[model samples]
Target chain A: MIGSRQHGGGVIAFTFIIALLLTVIPLPEGLRFLRPDWVGLVLIYWCMALPHRVGVASGWFMGLMVDLLTGTLLGQHALSLTVIAYITLKFHQRLRLVPVWQQSLTVLVLLVLHQLLALWISRIIGRPGVPWYFWMPSVLGMIIWPLVYVTLRGLRRGFRVS
Target chain B: MLVSLSVVLMVMDHRFKSLESVRNTLSLLVYPIQLIVEIPGTVTDWLDESLATRRKLQEEVDSLRTQQFMQQAQMQKFAALQAENIRLRELLDSSFEIGEKVLIAELMSVNLDPYKHQVVINKGELHNVYAGQPLVDADGVMGQIVHAGPYSSTAMLITDTSHAIPVQVNRNGLRTIALGSGTINRLELPYIPNSADIQPGDLLITSGLGGRFPQGYPVATVSAVQHDPGNAFASVVATPLAHLNRSREVLLIWPGHTTDINSVVSAPVEASAEKADTEAAPENGEAADNHSTAADTATATP
Candidate 1:
């Protein structure tokens, strides 16, 4: 069990690294709006799968990394990510029991909440007037939740990440 | 607790300099992740270069050679004009401006936030890159460095909404401020008077009033001028000359610090040994010559 836990930790970190890479990778200007929130999706999955291990603190750390990586205001992403993780952890038991599609709907809410928090922060910093397409990533994140869920689940089971 | 901590951090980061050291330290940890993310793009670029046809490569070389020759001819005229300007400036008893020492840095990442126009370049504090340092491309001014990490730096492009540069109309030397309009292609001159001499197609260059960007770099061209008689100011818009979306490499300039020429020439070679391309040497040599000539004029000024 100890060995499996250690292995699980590595897998989780690996996935987070991949998600970070996806978050910052350059895409065509037209498709940028369609790019899913990869880090938030991965964070949600891990929080749901292992709430005790990947909770608010881990989420905050991941947020800080994202802030540093994207060169945004320090703690901007951290605050949003921490809230998302907290919400996921609070309802992880029920979240794990729901069907994948329903979970995706919930994921949509969380992702939107994540974006809303970031938007609120930016507005407070005096950067307002984002376009309507700002909400596209949340919807795209929802659409990709199932794919992320299945793949992470397969990796979890294969690696005995429990 | 995490929320409050984050809020405190944001306040410190945005409102104070207390978090700068913390940010720099954290950015060092974040550097490897950025480098890893850049690998795929770098690999594809390398592949593209290696896979290009012989005929295409020859054609590119031929074109670049012709372009170089034309630039050299222009440089000859520029040298003559600069000499005349120096003599005239000496007669007027004013300090003459020297050529800025420049280091080339490749863009590591593109637009991080859709709302914020920022790019990461491979050069950083290790190469003496600093915040507020001007960035330029082959065509014109691009942006200025905002955060300089150990191995990389983040630059906020001139098109970022919060950015503004002091500019002058190249035609009449009419000084005004150019403000970024949150779009890559557009910049706004919000304070131009309705009866101002500015018109569409007039070129705007940095006025050097703001010490952040050096003078005389092409910034933008007036694309539209709307005279709203009801309003106090005309709504003038311009398209930035720099290829903000396309350029892969940018030059970081040490403005008015010609004394650092030797360090500028040798620093990048020592810092990023892999990037010690042969192209940099000749460019630095040319810049050094310009600096020496300017220095001579500075001393010769009674």
Candidate 2:
């Protein structure tokens, strides 16, 4: 709790809300599949950065918001985010110690796992997959990970948040 | 625990429609987020419209004036035909059909999943939109509203796998069902017999058999018809006339109660004709059957 002591709940909430908004912003048709899972990425960052403050419940709540926005089967995103948050929290100390590039690799794997879980649920509910490109967001998330990580780290330092 | 709760919700929503109110309440929270996200696009569209060159605007106005004049002339003939139709029905002691009412709605967002052909529209219960209201664009029938919230509603396009529309061939009046093929731009007439009069270029319009959609809107044009000697049912596919992926605006139709429309519309004329028609009961019976069939076609969903 000492490391995250200065991080107000308000800042955490602001980040999550912004991330949710980013997820809903309309993208061009051709680039739709490549739209990164903003909520998933933000949840991962928070769970890894402040494991004690943000964990399974936060992920579950944000996942529900995504479901409401996209009108997918309710609880679909919640289930995936819960599992990812659990995994991230369990490995938070080790994940925090990794180099940025290595962390991106790990984040890529987590995102792919998140998508695979979502894909499996959609398949159960009988939604046909579009194409191989549907998984491209995991790759894009990996590419953007370093930038997000550095910016958030800078924000934390500047605000003296933890 | 949360996972199981969500599963329960999904099953309940799919099977019983118990979560409709829940979804609507949650959508009230979602409405603002949608508006905020749409602001940028709206501003860009506004800028384009306002910043257009005066010459381009003049040309557009001139062309639109000519088009309006032509359409108004055509509409005058249509109105006369409708009045004549009602008068003829009055003479025959049959019912009259009422014209449908429409509300203009703009598309807010398309569902991100390509598998689900659904869009959110700006109109909802506030505008008297309801579930099963048919939607159309400039070209033809687009889809129907599946969920109506307070300020917004969701429409499932004609291309969804679960959607089916009753259609008749314009060339021969052969009736069939056009089932959404889970692909945009195409619908399948799976059960049409090989001997059916359908061809590659035939036009399919709503037969008004389905109680959901009103009669006579163009649904699709037959794009391909493959008949095999060994197969009983021909493989027929048609392209939707509406710009399903492109249209930003849609017309929501209120198909007013069709049953007593004839008596309601011809009340004044009915006074004189009713007395005379009473003398010819057999003619009235035949005319009533024809009128009822027309009424049934407008309301019948199946």
Candidate 3:
């Protein structure tokens, strides 16, 4: 049982690393707004699947990584991701009971909340206002939710993460 | 608890600016992930290089040789001009020297935050790259390094909304500040007066007023100038001469360091060729001359 728990921890870490990689990978100028919030999606998935293991602290850690990698205000992404993890943990029981499509709707709200918090921080720090397209990533993250959900679910069952 | 901790971090970072050491330490842990993401790009570049045919390679070499010959010819005239300028400066009893040491750094292909015009370069404190060091491409000034990590650094492109550079008109030497307009292609000159002798197609070069950037490097070309009677200042727009989106390599310059004229004159051609060899040697040639220029537009405008 201890060995299985260790394996599950490794799997979770590997997935987070992959998500971090996808978060910063370069996309074309036109398609940049369409780049999904891969880290946020993965964090939401983990928080919903194993609330005890992946909660606010994991979200905060990943967010700090995003901030360092992206060169934003040090705590900007940390705050957003912590809030996201908290919300996901709060609703994980109800969210897991629903179908994947309905779970995606919840994911959409979480992603939007994440973006809004980030935007608010940017404003407070005197950054210029973004245009309408700045919110496109949340919408794109919503669309990509089902795919991330199924793949992560398969990996979780295979690894027996719980 | 995590939220409050993050909020405290944000306040420290944005308001007090005291968390640089902490950020750098965290960046060290995050560097491996950055390297992993960069592998696919490096692999594609290698594949492209290895797959090139001999004829294609020969053609590239021939073209490069022809370009080098042309540049060498121009360097002769530049050498003569430099001697004359030095002689004139000496006659005027001035001690301003023009040469600076340059190190080539490749832009890591990570696009961080579309809203923030930041690019990562594979040079850092280990390479003697400091915060606020000027970055330039072959064509013109690119930007300045904002955060210097141990193995990599973050640069704010001149097109970022929060960035501004001191510039002067090449034709008449009318000085002004070029502010980034949050777009890649454009820079805004908000301080130019309606009656200022600036026009479309006038070349803007670094005036060296701020002590942050070296003097006389091309910054942008004035693309449009419009006078609004309602406003006191002219709405001047310039297109940055540096290929901000396209250029893969840039030079980190150490201003006031007197390196060999060959490196300075042939910077465009040699930047890519000698990048691998010069990556290790941190050339601390001389102290930077920080004498402020006559106009202080950088502080006034921004």
DockQ of each: 0.70, 0.42, 0.84
Mind sharing the TM-score for model 1?
Answer: 0.89
Candidate number that wins on DockQ, 1 or 2: 1
Which residue window of length 10 is worst by lDDT in model 3 chain B?
Answer: B282-291
Of candidates 3 and 2, the better by TM-score: 3
Q: Which stretches of candidate 3 lie over 4 Å from their true place?
A: A1-5, B262-302
What are the per-model numbers of colliding residue pairs?
0, 8, 0
- Candidate whose TM-score is highest: 3
Docking class of 1: medium
| Share of native interface contacts present in candidate 1 | 0.71
Ranking by lDDT: 3, 1, 2
Which lDDT value does model 1 have at B73? 97
Give the C-alpha lDDT of model 2. Answer: 0.77
RMSD (CA, Å), each prediction: 8.9, 6.6, 7.6
Q: Of models 1 and 3, which has the larger DockQ?
A: 3
- CA lDDT, candidate 3, residue B18: 66
Candidate 2 lDDT by residue in tens digits, A97-133: 9899999999999999989988887777666665788
Model 1, B118-171: lDDT tens digits are 999999999999877889998889988888888899998888887877677999
Worst 10 residues of 1 chain B by lDDT: B268-277
